[model samples]
Structure formats: C-alpha cells, structure tokens
Target chain A: MLKKMENNTGNFYIDVASIQKEKHANEICGDVFLTKKVSAEDRTIIVLSDGLGSGIKANILASVTASMAVNFTSMNAPLAHTAEIILSTLPVDRERKVGYSSFTIIDIEAGGTIHFVEYGNPEILYFRENETLELKKTPVTIKNRFRLKQPLFYSNCTGRRNDRIVVCSDGISQSGIGSRAYPFGWGIKNVNAYIRDEISRHPGISSFDLCRKLLANAIANDTFKAKDDITAGVVYLREARRLMVCSGPPYDENKDTMLARDLDRFAGTKIICGGTTANIIAREMHREICTNLSHTSFQLPPVSSMDNIDLITEGILTLGKAHRLLEEGFKPDLVSKDPAVMLCNHFLLHDEIVFVVGTKVNEAHQDPSLPVELEIRRNVIKKIARELEDNYLKTININYI
Target chain B: MTEITICSGTLCYIMGGADIFEIETKLSEMYNDKIRIKASTCLGFCEGENKQNPPCVMVGNELIPDATIEKIINHLKRLYTR
Candidate 1:
C-alpha cells in the first residue's frame, strides 16, 4: 500500500502519459519520448524532444536527445552541464540556424515536488482543478568548454491530487500557424483556455485521455493534415487503478487448482477468458458456471459467468473480436456490453494489467466454420499487449503458466 | 514440386510454437527450387470433433503434428535425397 503524504496542496499518486501524431502521411514522427522512470516508486521523470525537421533525421535527433536527457538525469548531472552538452552535441540546421533538437523535461519527486526544464520548446501549462496556474521560471545560461552557449527555462512547484501538467511539441502550441482558422498560430494563451475549458467539462479525464484530446484538437486545428509532428505529454496526479486478467488454461490438468487459487488470490478485479478455461476454474473452485445466452455480436459466441470471475468469455472468439475492436481504437461507450467489450473496458480503465496466460490450447478454436481471424489466440493477445503498451501506455505483466 | 502448407490460423499457431511460421524461410533456403511453402487459412485441426495434432504442417499428402524445424527439415531431406 502507498502511504499518502501531503504535498503543498493535497495527497495524490502520480500518473504520467503521452501520445504522438506524425505530420500528414509521414512514417516517422519527429517527436521522441523518455518515460523510463515513471514506474519508480518515489520519482517520476518524463521528457519529450522534438527534432528540428521531420521524418527519419528528426526522429533520430529527438531519440538521441531524449535518451541522453534520461541518462544524464539518472546520473544526477547538473542541468546546466546537461543543457550545454545537448546544445553542442546536436547538429544545427544551416539555414534555420537552430539546434536540431528541443526538449521538455518534467521530474517530480515523491510528495509532489515538481521540477521541470524547457529548452526551445513550448511552455507547459499547469492546472489545479480546472483552474490554470501560471508557473514562474528562471532562465539559466549554459556554457561548456567548447564555448557553446544555450539557455534553458527552469521551474519548480508543488502539486495536489487534481493537478495536471501538459507539455507538448511546437506542433501543438503553434498548430495552424499560417492557417485561416486563427490567422495566427494556436498560441499558448489559446491552448491554455482550451485545456481549462476541457477540464471543466470532463473534470475526471485521465492524463492519457487529456493528452490525446489536446493532441487531437491540435491536429484538428491543422485541418487533420498536421503542419508538424504533434505530441503531448500529460502528468496527472490522482488515485491508483489495478486489474488482473486470466486467459487460456494450463494444458496440465493437475495445475487447474493452482490456476484457480491464483485467480482467487489476486486482489484486483479478475477476468477469466475462454469457456473451457472458465469451466476449469469453476470446477476447481467448486462453483457452478452460468451461461449468459445474450448477444454482443451475433456472429460470436455468447458469454458465461461463474463465481469470483469478474468476466467470463468464449476464449479466442472474444479475444479476436476484442482485438479488432481495440485495434480500431478502444472506445468504451462505442463497444457494446459483451464479454469482449467488457474485457476491453477492463483493460482500458486500469493502470496495471496482470495477464495470466495458460499454455493450454483449446481444441474448439481450430474450427473451420469460424473466421480465420478468430483462430488467432496468442498472436492477437500478443498484439493486445503491444497495443495497450504503445497506445494506452498501460503497464502489463504477462505471466505464462 | 512438393506442396508444403503451413497453417496460419490461430489454434495451430498457439498450440504449436509460433515458430511454425518460420518454416517457410528454412524450407526455401534448403530445398531452393524443390519445395513451395504457402499459408492455409485453416486446416480444420486442433478444434471441433475433427481436431488433429498441431501445429499441423502438410508435406504433400502427409500432415505432420507439432512440426518443428528439425522434424520438417529431416523429412524434407529424406524425401528429396531419396
């Protein structure tokens, strides 16, 4: 259990999230991210770097800069030295006369002492319960032996449960720069007001969704064809969420008791997938399996229920169908209340996902009558793991038993 | 010419190692011109009443279960060498 300590304002847990958008049909996004320290119990470190240009070069530059930033922070290097190193090392665009990479670093210690540095990047907007808080920054000039000189803006603050910090690339702050919508760029003032309005309306949005919303609206301001690579990193301090999913069953019949006991022992919400797997757990627990013969998708099999299993589903069909739905972007309300959708919602809502995957293969999954796509069990689940990590930024632990 | 069908469907992919798909490159690299590896949507094995051992691979008319790199390569070597 996490002991709640009072920060300057209130006690809360830290949650950091980010999302990216490449300009137009470009394969490479110029924005690179560093979130290596978020899972640390006492500290949170997140950095977003935007390379000078777009595509491969930009990606490489941003990647190098973000990686170096994380490494330096880990080594506890001075911010001035770190800034000078980056400014000198990164190549400059000849015509633009600008360093190839710019980054924003947000570092928060336990008990919500927030420290951040912005270098040639958009200023981050801090909020406290739908009301905006203006940050006070000190400019530090960085110089190295190479005679390279660069300046970085540094700031510090205290945070509460409902505080949100949104930092983004110029793609967001300068969205629709020359567009007819505003005739001027989507400046900091405009972005600030928009976020305040959004917070007031939703109030309970997760940091991930808030970042996504900001990026989406920013891209929309650029008329879907973004003029730049848009990226937003959101750090939201709030309560914690945890979830556990049990999919498949062990091939060894002897371990059924172990699997059942594991599910029963799991403190978080438990989801059991696969009809046979659910039956195995039910039989092991000496509980009756109740069949729910309702319809989620007419083409897929119906759902089932048993005691202690938060969700019971028809193995591959539910997983495959859910993968397709989630692949299209997991929208909680849009998905019907089927086992798969319910399971997807469970995955989306929680911060931590514990996947207990049984190696047992269900004989029913190879049926020729079913769609070939439904026959995919491991691959789809594997895809789900990747998608959850990449898109939703959920921490997943796959326990293969 | 030999017809080697690899089941790309889910059950076989999972029950048998996902490496079953990698047989294509190995077969191609070895037999060069003699073997043709193709993906079958579903071979109707590992599910229903007609389920068979999987991950299933077909070497011409013979369907091999739990097809491994060594097992498939040995069979190919036997058939072509003979």
Candidate 2:
C-alpha cells in the first residue's frame, strides 16, 4: 500500500501503487519506479524509468534516472532543465555509444491538478468512468551544452473523482515483441483495451490490484518469461475507505453512553474488540450480539456479531496477536478464522483506520494465574496503530476515551 | 429450534470450552436446521457457585457445567428426540 498524501484539498483520496517484473534470467529489474510525497506542498511525484538493457548496468542507470526525475520534479525545476540534467547525467554505453533511458514523470498537486512529462516511454493512459480520456500533449525539445537534443512531451490536466492515470515502461507496451501472438508487440492500443475491460468488470478496482493485473498480463504476453523489465504505476483518485475500531471500555462508567453515541454516529465500518466494550454498546443502543461459534479458532476466542458492526472479537489477546502478525509482515495466506487475522485483514483492506480505545483496565486480566502475554489494552492498541502507520502505510488515528 | 449458547469468556475458553465450539459443525451435520448454536462472551455463571465447573454451556433452558463435545451432543440428541 502507498502512503496517502495527507491534507488533500479535494475530497477524493489519491492511491498510488506499482508492480515490477524483471526480465527472464536477470537477477534484478532494469526498470525503477519511485514515488515521493511532498507533504509540505501536499503534492505527490511518481517517476518510472527503464534503462537500455538488462542486468547491473541497466539497473543502475534506471535507478539514477528515476531518483533524479523524482527529486527534480519535486523541486519544481523547469521541464526542459530537468530533461537536460537527466540526459547529461546518463552514462553512455560502451558498445552502443548512446546514453539511453526512458522516463515518465507524473506530478499531482493537492487541488487535483496533474502535470505529466514523458520521454522515450509509452504515453500514460488516463481513464475516467471506464472510458479513455484524451489529454492534449505539447512536444518539448531540449538542446543542451552537450549538443544532445532530446524530445519530451508535457501535458497538464485536472483530475476528477474515480479518475485513473496509468504509466508504464516500454516493456509493457512491447511485451510480445517477437511472439507470434503479437507480431509487432502488445502495443498501447491493446493495453488500453485491456484496462477498459478490467474497469468495466470491477468499477471499484484499487490501484494496487490494477497494477498487479496489468503486470500479470504483460508477463503472460511474453509467455510467462518477460523479455524486458516491466513496470506499471497507477494513480487512483476516489473516495477513501474508512473503518472505526472501538476497543476496551471507558474508564468512567458515566462515559459509556458517550462511547456508544460516537459509535452509532460513525459513517463507516465499525468493530468492537472487547466483551465489555460490546456489552456497553449493546446496552446503550438496545442491540443484541450473537456470537458465531462455528468460526472459532483454537488460538483465539470466537468472533461475535452485533447490529451495525462489521466484526466483534476479544480484546487484548487479539490485538496483541495482530500486532505480532503485522510485525512479521502479514500476508493473505496467513489469514484464517482467527479473530486476530480477521482484525488484521480489516486494517489492511481500509485506507483510513480510527482506533477508539477505552482506558479502563480489565480486572480479570490482572489475575496472577492468567498468561503474562496479556498486555495492557492501551499499549496493545498503540503498537497496532504504529505498525499500521509505519509499515503498512495506513492512515491511523487513535482516540482515548 | 434448539438454541445452544456456549460461554466463550476467557476463563471458560481456557477451561475446555474451546473444543466444545466445534460441536456446531457436528450438530449441523447430524440434525441440520433443528439446532441454532451461538456463543456468549461470558454467561456470568463462571463467577458464581458453578465457577469451579467451567466451560459452561446452555442448551435450551438447561445449563450444563464442564461442557465437552460428547456431553453437548448427548444433550442435543435428547432435545432433538423430544
């Protein structure tokens, strides 16, 4: 998951994700994709660069080009100057005598304005509501002191909600170069058609999934062996997916009503983590919780169901286990009927997570006979929040009741 | 429908209620729609007179202490036959 640009002016949330596949038999990919969020300006810059060949030399070239493109773009350097610096900095190949690397730069501002610059790479594909958008591009020519004149394309447009911008290396556009399936290569036209079909089928497809699908198709076009380094970067503008998790019970019995009221007013998915916490909400809202014994996991207590709540589980233990799973880099395969796994899945699926933790201590957990791993509720919640923010790039907010 | 509520509180679970939960699948296969199984965070009975006999389970209106799969199944069979 990509870290979202905070304080976005437009209501739409920007999701940026990418995938890369190295050429067959190569230890490292020759294509490099870099994304940097300029928090001060509330802007994001993405750069994709593909070098001349495969292996170490190409990898270094692509990395240098991509890093320079990201830094120059973020610094607001003139388009021509940025191109000149990148072109002059690229080292010439001893055999070909040509310093070559294809690059695509995308700069998106807070108010939905986007500026794109492309050189040697395929033109970015823009989609709005499952339809291809035609962006007018101006050709730019840079003549530098090295007497090397390079042609670059510049385009700018405003982004709308549900709009998607996809940029790729030539490897994606030329996946099946010599294959009988695509005599001249996969081509941009076919790639655009595939994306259109994908959008029509799943209107709410995320940038990460879209990029993965695109890369998979590109590799298949090469008969499951990529001929060159392939990379796809997707920028999606859409409404954010939010989730609210209420754990533990408030310290003061008087504040129980307040917790329930806040939960009732939440606009997104809701979860209750503690038995006492769920009881408080059920009592205040006059609702019932029906536990599902069939989904019980040996390691954790069975999950329960409540009105208007997405999931209900045992607190401390589940949260502590979830924190450990995230720390070890949780994956889909690790998922089971375990409440901790379910909680981790919910945290991973949403873009924004709000944790409403109650400060009250559960007297039962303080018993000496109980396992020592039963950490304090507040401490466990804090650990989970930190893992989500630092590792998973999720937007997290904690409210102590 | 025979409603079976199993206590899944920390104390009950630790005392063998965890294994009793799997009876849902067994009861469903044997009796199907006749059994309605659910779990409760705490039946509030574990802290009282029957605290020593935990993993508690309630079948219909009858409360059974020290619940096991066979014991719960026997109770279910009796209820279904009635």
Candidate 3:
C-alpha cells in the first residue's frame, strides 16, 4: 500500500510508502503490508508480515497477522498482548507444527516518537544524515497457554527531520539464497550498504521511490525470480514538497496583481491552469508564455511554459480532463505527454497541493450551447481537491479569489 | 527565423485556434527550421472592436484575424517568398 500521511509536528512531514512482490509462480504475495493514519490520535501505524510459505494459505496467514498487528498497535495494546492474539489467531501449519508468520509493526506518534516491534522478522534500519543508526532493542518473551514461548523485540526512539525508518520482510534479507554470489543470502549488511549509497547519490529521494529501488534490487538479487514474497516499507521524515496551482482569473480584475504577487512569492512548484490566468501572471510579471508544441496531445491541449512557472495549460477543459484522469487513478508517467496527465502528476507527486482559483466567469463558457461538462471553475477545482485528499491522502488547500 | 504566435485564449481556442496548433507538422516540413511557432495565453486582442475577430495569429509583425491553418500557412508561404 502506497499511502503518505502528514505529521502535524510543524517542521517535518511523515511519508510512509511500501512496495511488495509476490513469490515466483504465486498468485498473491505471501507478504501483507498495511498502513493506517488515525487522525484523531495524530498517529500512523505501518505493518508488514511475511507468512510461513508461499501461495494462498501463506497470504491468508500474513493478512491476518498484519491486520491484527495494525489494529492492536493503534489501540495502544501491550506488545505481548498483541503478539499473543496474533499467535492464537494464526492456524498452525501441519508440517512446521507451528502457526507461523513474521511481522514488523511501526507505530509513529505525532511528536516524532516511534515504537517499533518485531517478531521473527528482519530488524528495521534507521538512517539519518547518510549514516545508519544502531537502534537499541529490548527482547521480550511472551509465555501464552496456546504456545510455549514467543520472542519479540521492541525499540523506542525519537526521530528527527531527514530520518528514515526502513522495514522489510525476511524475503528481502533472504533474497538470493542458495545463489553463488550470496550463498547465504543478501543479508541486512548489504541492504544497509545499498540504502546508504542510494541516499548519498540522490540526497532527496522520497520514501516511495527509495522503496521501489530497494525492491528492484532485491528482485535482481534473486536472479529476477523471487524465492518468496518480498516487501519493503520506508517511513521518511522530511520537509514537505509543495505545489501551487493558479487557475481562472481573479474575480476582481484589479486583484490580478495580487494573484501574480502570490504566485511569485510562493517558494514551490507553480502551475497556471487557465489561459487568462496565465496571461494575467505573464503580463504582470513581464514574462512570455512559450507553448510546448513537441508534446502535443490530441486528447488535451498542449502544455506551455513561462518564466518561474512549472507548467501552464488551458484552464477549464484541461482541468476537467485532469479531474477525470485523477478519478480514474491514472498513472501520469505512462502517458505524461498529455497536459491533463501532467497536471494530475504534479498533484500526486507533491506532499501538499494549494489551488489559487480565480472566481471570474468566462463569458465564452457561459454559452448554453457549450458542453454541459464545462462546470464552473471553482466546482472543478473543488472536485479535484476532494479526489486528491480522499484517495491519495494529499494535503489540499483551495483559496478562491 | 519567421515567428508565428497563436492565441490559446478561451475565445480563440473555441473559435478555431485548436486546429491551428496542428499546422506544426505541415510547417516543419515546409519551412524546416526557418519558422518558430509558439502559443500565448490570451493576446488581449479579442476585446472591444477586436472581439469580432478571434482565433488570432501573429505572423511576423502582421496579426491575422480569424486565423486558420490554411491562412497561417499562406501567410508563412508569403513570408518565406519575401
């Protein structure tokens, strides 16, 4: 599950993302990854569980363990109690003679405190400022009636901005098992080295992209065929990437300068959606709108460029099409040439999206003969903002001028 | 290089500038690198008396009102011949 949650810690945003690959020939991944944000509590919980074997049975075991881990942790249950519940719930394997599933639970509070618990899973790696930190873990043994004894490791730490917590299943650490290069396995040491090098090379890599790179490397270690279900989750605390979208013209013509001034003052990616809106900014800033003809799409109008503006496009039509694409859960990278897709991509990629919507109604669109789909500018922006917030978990702000 | 500016404003786009953007393929084959084409947001020409003419294009210093692909092509041809 790829979900990002914003922390109200004021200085940093908490981005949590995960990527998983099913074992070779398995219909479903035996590893289950889950994330949830409790808004009232201002807490985020991430769970990753790897089952005993590959295929559907293993998937069910992992799913049950992961879901229970997330719920228990969110409810502030004791670690031993959570482990007991999970162990009792899983069905025992006939051959192994044990109900088997390995899980890692990460509970992050609003004040930067992280509670990490692991049972039969690889240790989570904590990195800050290009160096990995050695986390102190306390081992606890849970003696329950159903099972003899289960060992769990608990670690509590406070994270700062630019810190990352990476958790993965045994499948990742055990990748390339029995292979000549890594006869033992691609152990945690190699994974740590790879992550360190990646952060050094790309200092600002997002948590989602880092997980993708790690997963790709792990898949390659197994000679392009994973021996078991692999899962990698990264929780990154960093400054938020913001994008401001200015659409339509301001309600009052005199306030056009105010729009331009706001856009100029914004210290983030800037996108102008409407022609008149772009013109207002261009004229006020004394910049030229250079239309990009190379990447023209028949479905949507071609995108344009201007000084200090990241993207410029035709307003209502492009926005409407972009809204539809976002609603469809379109991936912008696949067909990025379209103006609508480009807009949607910006909205998804950024941590926060701010829309500066102008309220002036264009007389041209008022014609009843025009397509009824030409909704009012504010309504379209509102729809897009809603989709972004609800589906993608993005922080959205719409200011109607 | 000859410059052609197409108005991508709302009125111009609805009037016919949408098809004018397609003239790039034809112009690239005809003029090669001799012409540069760009689009601007509302050239501010479609107001007052100029409101009667839309889908405006600027070919060099001359503004072609109610522009089309063919008209822009003809204007480009004339400019190249000169």
List, residue by residue over A1-401, the lDDT tens digit for candidate 1.
Answer: 12223466655656677889998888989999777654454566788999988988789889889988987876678998887787778776666776668888887777678888998888889999788898899999876445655568999998778788999999998898888887688998899999999889988888878888988888888988989999988887876566777877786778889999989888878887775577678778898766453342334445666777777766676788787877899766536766677788888777778888888765465456543535545677888888888777777788877
Residue A18 miss distance in model 1 (angstroms)? 2.2
DockQ of 1: 0.04
A136 Cα displacement, candidate 2 (Å) = 2.6
Index of the highest-lDDT prediction = 2
- Per-residue lDDT tens digits for candidate 2, residues A1-401, read 45454234457778888999999999999999998888798888999999989888898889999999999999999999898888888998888777778899999887778999999899899999889999899999986546767679999998887889999998899999988999888999999999999999999998989999999999999999999899999999878889999998898989999999999899998999987788899999999988876667547788899889999998776788889999999874435788988888888878899999999876656667753447888998898999989888788999999
Comparing 1 with 3 on lDDT, the higher-scoring candidate is 3
Greater DockQ among 1 and 3 belongs to: 3
CAPRI band for model 2? acceptable
Candidate structures ordered by DockQ, highest first: 3, 2, 1
**Per-model fnat list:** 0.06, 0.41, 0.45
TM-scores, one per candidate: 0.61, 0.87, 0.92
Q: Candidate 1 vs candidate 2: which has greater DockQ? A: 2
lDDT of 3 by residue, A112-132 (tens): 788999888888999989999
Q: Where does model 1 sit among the CAPRI classes? A: incorrect
Task: Choose 2 or 3, whichever is better by DockQ.
Answer: 3
**Over 4 Å off in model 3, which ranges?**
A1-10, A144-146, A332-335, B27-35, B45-49, B61-66, B74-82
